[model samples]
Target: MNFTPALPKPFTEIWREAYRYNEKDSPRKSSYQAPGKTPVPFILGTTKLTGGFSVDTSEYPTMGYWSNVPRNEKPQTLLVTGYLRGDNYIKERNTLIESLRILTSDEDPGYLELPLWGRFPVIVTNWDVSESGGKNGQCEVSIGLTRTGMPELQRRDTTGVMGLFNKLENTADSLKDAAVLAFESAVDGINAPDTIADSFTQIKTSLLDIAGRIQGSRSSLNEITGGLSSITNLLAQGERNPRKLASALFDSGKQIVDGIIKIRDTFDDPELFFTIKDNVKNMLQQLLGVKNFFLDVDTVTIKQQVIKEEAERLFKITAFSAASQLMTKLEDPTFSQINSYWKLLQDLEGSINMDDTNIYTAVQEIFMTVAEELSSKNIAAELTTFIKTPIPLPFLAQMLSCDEKKLRRLNNFSDSFLVEGEVIYV
Candidate 1:
């Protein structure tokens, strides 16, 4: 075989041809960036990365080795190796060292980009630098990164996105006496036993107290309050009829939500929206907390139990209905809050028995409405975040580049206490 090595090529032309072939935007594989900061770019070498669905497993003592696995994932992490070298190796290395700053409570996370994998929002966990006097122009760095942003960028169609959430007819009537209808669905075919007439009488006081609380929510929403007083008369009608009592409580719940709606209708301030949501949430909690909702009877008969079950389920459905309605009226509620609200929806969904046609259908309608609302209103998902340990509100606000006062308005704090738990920022 005649070797083609007969033709010797100049190294300059060879290197130029290689560069011409590799000239494209994708040639650079890795970089780092902080919010509002320029990206720090560098060449990368071999990488050892570890990331996937995070899972928790529990080892159990059984004849067959088995582990309990929860349907949850831990945060993804990466072990990255890269290099920095040039004629000015020390300067380049120092520049990288400055770029990969130490992690701190108030520092915004930097992003890491890899060859094939997408860029990751990460806070540097730890890092090591390897150097030797002989290898003056080259050094290898290993870094650990815990990915952030569990509620990643929520992509949606922006075509004709305006008025998406507002498109729904403002028909609060669909929810009027929703509790009554839900309860009736439960006791529809099966008549309540005569012995059970006094079943939920114990909750009478709680119902009235909830109504009174709604009226006292604020003096500004006088229109909603004035109508709430009439619910007491409805309360008397409910005294003998558990369904009617639930309706009265529902009236209270609706009135509170309506008060929030009125506030949202009148004001554009985010604080007012969250304020109304917080107040209505309290009212709903009180209504849901009504004693004897599950019944106190020693032996719950099938008929009696059916009514009781309906009472419990519809009470939640009623409160959640009010919640879902109010959620639609909120302005930029944090995605973190939405996540918590989503969990509440899950609990409500679990409690509902599909066989109960009456209430199930009604509750499902509300579910669909809220799902749409979240899609339309999930604009602040990028702004939402959570912290494990306690951090000062001002510092947390600083980290998010948000105003401290505005942060307070965006989140519900029980008296400017420590801000250690889940936080939402608009």
Candidate 2:
């Protein structure tokens, strides 16, 4: 057999010795003595096998034993470390945890696969069976991979580790890309005058809304990492446990697809998907309310009647002057940075001629057109898609809303825009 045995040694004690002397920076040299010095078996030592596999040992400080190894039981704990070049440590740990947690007991332990030195693999165990009689008996039991039933375990674990590593690396790269893209998008939004309205208060509110939406999107993207981790572990065993593997893969895929659906759904129902949309709508409504109040003001008409001695009181309010002041406030450099529409406000006021009915109508139309232009394009498109294709209420309502009545409406709206949110006339 390729495996060799050095001598009978306490597994835990040998592991301790390995740590003290085997470290790269250590000056201590280990020598074997018949009785006084620790004598460990070759299998217990860090053994480099052919085919790029190495089995090793490590020792962690143990907790107080509930009951000591129990009367010559030699119930020892050794950190079994494995080093494999093209393997995944995290995946191995996860698989081993899943497969073996129900099987192994610390009080009377069994063997397990574990990481050593970053990517190394090791078998952990109590390593002694009193019933087996002697060290030879124990060593005999330890011989071959079948005893631990860990060859298949190793196969599964190796696949799992490699898959997990690749997935984690991919997720990390994706998150990095997301960060870069978000930054670029923000820069674009900041520079685009048409995207933001000029008015310090409005611009500030818009910036906050954009920031919130971007943050929400980033958070959604971050959730993919957990989903990916599950997929990696699940798919690694696709060849071994096709059914379970398929289930896991399916579940992960569903999560990603569901997230995309949520994206579409949230856009369609702005009030539901993002608080920012609600805030924007509210702000616009307030602006429209102000315009409506201005529209209601009574202006005196110029009239003269000789027979009836009709008289008219001329309300000489400089409407243009007040409008110019409003425009100037809107065009302030601070607000202009966010939006360019304030530059058109001057044209809006000049268009209003209270004396001419046609001019008055055109002026009001100009202002209304400018205000309507504030709808964000991206938000609008997402909303339109959401309105056309509503998400299933049974699936989404639990997370989106708690109101039963609203949930039903949301669900119905998904089927058809049988009901709609109000339209504010600018």
Candidate 3:
């Protein structure tokens, strides 16, 4: 009998049919699929591969024998090894050698392609090549690659020269404000009287008026003070600029002279006059002395030299004069006193130039000391009176039992006065 038994389907075909049947019966079919093409077995920048190739990956262990807890995983490292062979193996090897050299030399990481794992960005930590003695034209290379996870960013500049300049500018501005505030405070201190008398009140009002004029000037004293805020600002502008600081100082000095003139004019006005008692005359003389201290004898010449140090020196002198005047004004026995004037004088003296040091030490000391001494004595040689008839100074000195020269020294008199109604102090 030549009859053949019926053969079963091929194993692959039978498996496919069985799989189709199972897939229909199940809720869903498994959709797993294999990759379409294998990756090229070569580093992107290197020669073609001929021999067996391998890729190695390693993970650092975070687990310790004593601990059950798992720590975060570390970055992975890959090791690659391959060979090149052919008629042009030498040329190919040279190309690969050159490529490896370039990759290793760069600071930045490079891309790598593998036959099995796909492409990755990696750093070539180390690389080496070997050649056999036989001229079969083949060479081997091994490369160590580390995964470049997240790139590190560069740091920024914070404390540079520009930053330092800004800091200095701000500091200079603050110092300038502090100086202005000190000046204003000193002015307030001088203006405040311990006891309100008619003459003192008038003088205080006149001083306030003068201050008002200074504050209201085209280039105000306040603005001038602000001009000194920064050396840079001073060097820049005109009105509030550094170069104009001297002009502002000059204006201040002129205003002070004008104020003194106004106060002097009041002395001749009958409407402002009071009984010229010894104490009253002393107070008036002190007022005149204070006013005289602010007289700018050469403001025009001073304004020509717009130097910073000169302007600062002038300011100190003005402040000192004002303080001295205040000291004299507050010398009345009825006033509750303070030593602030003396303190301000000392501070100003330290700031002023040594060449200009004599005015405060000589003129103020001589007159003030004599006045204070005479005030302490309280020897009433004659009843306080406002005289209408003029008398000789010699006769008056004789009446007070004081030598004429001694009286002149004590009175700070440069010239003999027609004794008129002015009270004489012995």
Candidate 4:
């Protein structure tokens, strides 16, 4: 039989020496210590894990058991309770306070370091601090941290959408520039007869007013592109949002066409006492046609149509105005005196036509016919004998309602006719 040695009792000299430590040497050390010196266990106070399984239930008489549908796992909550007290309690307490402040801030998904569970991303939902006794600075802290799990990844195709918006903006700018150029060309081509100058001026003023209103609009893109404010209201509606910028461009273009049409219609009366050349009338009609194309056709097609129509319109107006001026010169009695009147009438009747090409050719022929008549007549001798005394030819022509150049040719006057004041016998 063997007998075991008796263990030393409490308060014995050997027990005190084995369990306690001197300032110089120690065999046992505490698990709770100053932070940074050693990692402490969370068990110094309490750590509670709170979570439960989540499921969905529905009543069905056919099945004996309730039908359960699987759902998301319930988030786990970690409740940490601890005390700050020791020789370095003040330092550790301050550090813990600062760390808690950071963890509880607006920063998303704060980090938690659990002694047994490792590190996790969490959100600090609640925190409480208490001092049971006064003046000792020993404090108890309770913190609640909720697990955040993994973050979701987002994917969107924004580049293509942004590119389309940019394209629309560029298209708007180009359309505005084109409209401005067209307007300027139309305005500059208005070589109105003296009888209709007032009416032409009124039309020009109205157009300029519209242009100014567009230029002064509040929207930057609209202002840059001369977009009317009235049309922008459509964009406020969600249904029309997709066409916002394109509609502005369309409206601006339409306004230009409408303005031109209005000018034409205002002077449309048969007995208006003034006449726009057939070509000028046709050009105005075609510009008006641009409104129809813009409204009915797609943007890609409409731009090309507008450009082609504008070029044709400018050409026709310019050519017709020039021809009308020449015709006015030949109508004077001075040039009429040299013509073979019957032959001239027959040639004119044969040349005139509904075809544009034929009409252009006829206009050229008329000019040539007049030139031939003047050259063949050799009226210099008659002109030389007709002038009696020096008189301002322009003033005389103005009084007679005839062209000054025709009067000068009739009296055989020189470029200094303004100073010569040569008068002619009508």
Candidate 5:
């Protein structure tokens, strides 16, 4: 089967248009209506929120054959409600809004009150913006949607994406690890809960290791995703029919969830987990490929082109200037001190090489000598920070440098404290 992912339109073209839009050159300028010639103000309000059902949970043990088994912990609700803003935007901003009464008028009566997608609560009217800053006095109306919508819409979009893959992967990983821990706990006669709790230490380290690997693999996919999020927001801003895009994204999310569910079902068995992991990885690969294809269109071409180009130019200039400054400071005292040891170490390392047999023999002899010296000492034999020196001269030199010779001489200086002792060697 052909495995090629679909590519969006060219990034350069989209970037060019995006650049123009950002310059504020495309939008129609608002008419300067003369004083005292006030247009009809738009009314902004929300529809009455109807009754809705929500799920709640409580812990309970499994019964009958699984009577001793603990209750499984999980999220209480699968879906939430209340987010409709169709009419509220238009009614609040009469100046920018051409179809002010479309959602609430007789032609579209009850549309404002309907739950968006049988879920989101729709706004019944325009927003109250007298509190929002304007040149006109109080009671004067403001036109257009607020800036807040962008972030809110993005939150929903990204949350959906995360829900599809992130939640599934996390849940799958947890279930797999938990099952293994439970089995081990049973074998070792330990409580399942205690084993699970102990497993967290290893689990935390494993997660950190995975995150480190991912960062190394592609230089932080999370950052890449965040940049893509901005592009998605920009697309949403000028979109004439946002619902179409939202629908497409949501459908894609559903497909991801279906794939995850399959993985979940197979997680218990090792062979199956490996198979499912491979398939899930393939899905992610496809998703990333699709995203990259769209990103080029979204970033390099459209209305955002100028911003991208400017940002690139600024970055190059900044990087070159920083490099030049670093070159100027390369010979500074601080740099010299920091790098001097590094060069010495490199030369030291380059000059040192040993044959395998000689290296092993030398290490063994050193260790044997250390053991012999430690055995001869009457002091307690404990491994501590004070490792015994392999060479007697170096040890004596180090001690002398630290004024240890003076301290030893002081200990032997007093005739009364000397106790007429004779010199002895071990």
Candidate 6:
């Protein structure tokens, strides 16, 4: 039930909340809520700061060694040069050292808040803290941070296409891990072999549908099918260990999803592009559609509840990732189609019927991406204007100031007059 902490805007909402994503002692808090009344400043004070941003890209051999797919936004990297000071040098040095220890080695990522850049969930990929005799009661520190994209039970927001993709990639990975954990938990709670076998059948059916849709895709279908086959055989042989089976299932699911994403790199065909994305999305929906009788029967067990919760989260996360890639892949997307994507996302949210605010955050970022990027190029592409009254075709000729024949052909008008004024697409 953890979320990336809510960031109203990168600079405006600089003061944010603090909560534990994995804390079991207390009921989980919303990622959108600001619980901490005060801001938690970095232990080190900055003297000078440096920052970076980049696009995550893959060179496509199929498109050509030099060609690449639409760039995914890379997490912004930070290099902060700062210092620690205290009345006692040893105490100040120890405090900074311990913070660095957790920053560098911990499995869970720690939050790094810059003065104006906004708070980020980050991993200290590399850092240095040093002290000298000349500089008594103080030490120089330089830290390198890469946004890990994994917010440990916190909400977050940032601007730019880079931030969107960075968070998306991490969220997708997080969703995968959570899905596996939930599946494993469910497997442990329900020991009935028949129930397990039926669930596996449902999984296989979903995978096969996806396999059929992507029949000619460059993705490795055989690999996905092969992994699932091995597990199905093992389950048939009375190998019912929950952990092992769940891990294998998780690997297979990830393999299929990874392969699906990889197919986008194979070639550029708009029709196939949408076909594959839609089919895979439908397969995921089907995967979620199957009713697990075991979950229903085991209502008394809380593990089942976790399984259901994770499934819902997984669904939304999957949709978010798919929408991100789709929007990015387009060279120039129209406001009409962008609006359609918004509708699809909204419908998805409505289907899930959960009151999660994080989905709306992702939606806003995507909508803004289209609006801001398109604003400068051609305002015409984004909006349309029309009248209810009928008008002659020659009326456009005089109004548009274009060559009459060309305008008429472009408008696809069969009659000499338009019954009602329409904003021509061109």
Task: Give the per-residue lDDT digits (tens) of candidate 6, residues 329-410.
Answer: 4434455655655456555544542232333333434445534544534322443347477677677567656456645433
Residue range 213-310, candidate 1, lDDT tens digits: 54223554566656555445654454445556566656666666666556545654554554554554555445334322455654457877777666
Which scores better on TM-score, 2 or 6?
A: 6
Residue 279 lDDT in candidate 1: 57
Better of 1 and 4 by TM-score: 1
lDDT of 5 by residue, 1-426 (tens): 111112213323454443345566652212212112333222222323223333223222222211122222221111111121233543434442333333432122211111121222122245333433443322333322211112345546654534333433333333223322333322343223222222222322322332222211122334323332432443445432322322222222333334344344434455444344333333323222221111121332332443223222222221221121111121112223224422432332223221222222222232233233323333321111222433343354363353333233223424332222332111
Lowest-sum lDDT 10-residue window in model 4: 1-10
> What's model 3's lDDT at 294?
28
Best by TM-score: 1
Write down the worst ten-residue block by lDDT for model 5.
75-84
TM-score of each: 0.44, 0.18, 0.22, 0.25, 0.17, 0.39
Question: Which numbered prediction scores highest in lDDT against the true structure?
Answer: 1
Residue-by-residue lDDT tens digits, candidate 4, 279-335: 223333332222222112122344334433433332233222222222222323333
Candidate 3 residue spans exceeding 4 A from truth? 1-65, 68-71, 103-107, 154-426
Candidate 3 residue lDDT tens string, 292-361:
3222222233222222233344454444443343333332322112233344345555555533222323
Once fitted onto the true fold, the runs of candidate 6 whose alpha carbons sit more than 4 angstroms away are 1-166, 183-187, 215-257, 268-331, 346-426
Q: Where is model 1 more than 4 Å wrong at Cα? A: 1-182, 185-204, 208-249, 263-277, 280-293, 297-301, 382-400, 408-426
What's the lDDT for residue 133 in model 6? 87
lDDT of each: 0.57, 0.29, 0.40, 0.41, 0.29, 0.49
Ranking by TM-score: 1, 6, 4, 3, 2, 5
Candidate no. 3 TM-score: 0.22
Full ranking by lDDT = 1, 6, 4, 3, 2, 5
Q: Which residue pairs overlap in candidate 2's backbone? A: 6-42, 80-122, 81-121, 81-122, 82-120, 82-121, 82-122, 83-120, 83-121, 268-386
Candidate 4 TM-score, C-alpha based: 0.25
Q: Model 5: runs farther than 4 Å from truth?
A: 1-100, 104-122, 125-163, 176-426
